[model samples]
Target: MDPGGRVNIFVDTFAWFTDPAHYTGSNAVQVRVFEHLELSALAVLIAAAIALPIGLYLGHTGRLAFIALNVANVGRALPSLALLAFALPIAFSLGLGLGFWPTLISLIPLALPPIMTNAYVGIRGVDRDVIEAARGMGLSEPGILRTVEAPLALPLILSGLRTASVNVVATATLGALVAGGGLGRYIVDGLALQEYDRLFAGALLVATLAILVEVAFGRFEARAVSPGLRSPADAL
Candidate 1:
């Protein structure tokens, strides 16, 4: 588009944001924002629950490492839209209906890979000598994981959550396409109505939210990880 067109779009987006009509009732921007965050948070939490244990077990026991690797690969390969499409039917069969369940279910896969991979890699990558030393000190297997390996691996484990959180937040926009609510409603509706401002505003909102989540996670990682335990890159 021309520069003039771009400028006009920005101006119109500003107008859309300022319009009071967009802030009330069920389709309000705040409501949509809440919906977006709620869906994204639920997806990430669920994914972490399912992936972390398996990754931790595999990483700790040094068995079935292939599962983590394969799961990560498959999750990365699966398209979010395709997963949403695949989930729609399953959701209906289970009487879960539309909006939340289908969208939330689809997003879980998008979050799984990073979390699982990080948890496994983080735990598995812990210095073997440290583990041996813990054992030498008479720590049991569970004690070693809880006290020794997990603490050292916490940064990377948290890194996976960071990645998953951002991914879920951004991709949650797709939920709007499946009769779900979120900032994406603006984009989908805008395109259909030929309202470029709404489309741009929606895109901008999603981007802003994603960036904020990333920054929040970054701060959290800094505080959560011990200065001594942080990787060299992190330390810098």
Candidate 2:
């Protein structure tokens, strides 16, 4: 398309967003935004559930620390697209089809590294003197980990979750590659039909969603964190 045509198409697409016709159906941008957030939320929840406990245990025990570190590094090093492609066949063979399961599985890896690394690093970064002080107070190991270590590590842990959430939300756009749905629907369909208008719209929505997620989390982190731990910038 010519520059003028592309510009016109972009304007037209932005205009479409304000039209009720574009948002009243199941496939509307409004609906797709919900679907996209649902997938991203599920992926983040699953990754956090799987990664956090192991990371905390390893960090606290000082055993199998290498394994926890390696798991995070491996997750970081893996390619998200390649991971999706590789899982597709196995998921298909298992009758999972080309939909939610396969796509979410791909996003898990994209999310795991940050959560795992942050959990481990956060816990380990807890001062040993503090741990000793807790122990001296007759705190059990579990008590120390729960009350002393975890609280102190909360900031880094949150930072990790934020990173994973952002990555998963952004990469969730790739769901369209395997017949899955999300905000990526617009981008995929636009590209197939040479609709630069809808393509730019989808890109805009995805970027906006990511920024919103970051801001929401930043606010939550600020509130959830203890006043003593709040940095100057994070202080309300």
Candidate 3:
């Protein structure tokens, strides 16, 4: 489009963002943003709860590497939209219907692979010297993992979380497909109405959220790493 058209979209987006109807009223942008946040958080938390332990254990032991392999394959093979469609039918059969639960179920898988892979890789990547030193210090396996390895692996773990969280947030836009009502409501409504202004607003909002999520995670990852991992200048 022309520069004028692009500028108009920006203007329209600003209007949508600032409008009281999209903020203070029922089913407004404010409400939708929270809905999106909640849905994304639930998916990420569930995935992390399950995937992190499995990945950490596998990474630490270097066993059942195939599990990560399989998960990666599944993640690669199925797009989130396809997963949501697949789950919708399955959920209906289970009497979960086509709404929040189905959307959550579908989106959880989208969050899993990165989390599991990162946890596994992070743990596995820890220095042999550190592992040996911890072992030599009479640290039990559990003790060593908790006290020595976990802190070191945290950066990568967070990196995985960062990736997963961003992906989940972006994908939650698909929730609108299932009537799951998120920030995506605007997009769907905009498309159905052929309202390019609302379309641009919704797209901008999601993109902004994804970028913010990434930046926040990046900051947390840097700050969260063990001091030992930092260079002298950084630590100082």
The per-model lDDT (C-alpha) reads: 0.91, 0.89, 0.86
- Each candidate's clash count: 0, 0, 0
lDDT (Cα) of model 2: 0.89
Q: Scored by Cα lDDT, where does model 1 land?
A: 0.91
lDDT of 3 at 85: 84
Clashing pairs in 2: none
- Model 2 earns a TM-score of 0.93
**Per-residue lDDT value at 212 in model 2:** 97
List all candidate RMSDs to the true structure.
Answer: 1.9, 2.1, 1.6
Model 2, runs deviating above 4 Å = 1-6, 231-236
Candidate 2 lDDT tens digits, 110-142:
888899889898999999998999999999999
What value does the lDDT take at residue 173 in candidate 2? 85
Tell me each candidate's TM-score: 0.95, 0.93, 0.94
- Structure candidate 3, residue pairs in collision: none
- Between candidates 1 and 3, name the one with more favorable lDDT: 1
* Best candidate according to TM-score: 1
Q: In angstroms, how far off is 227's CA in candidate 3?
A: 1.8
List ranges where model 1 is wrong by over 4 Å: 231-236
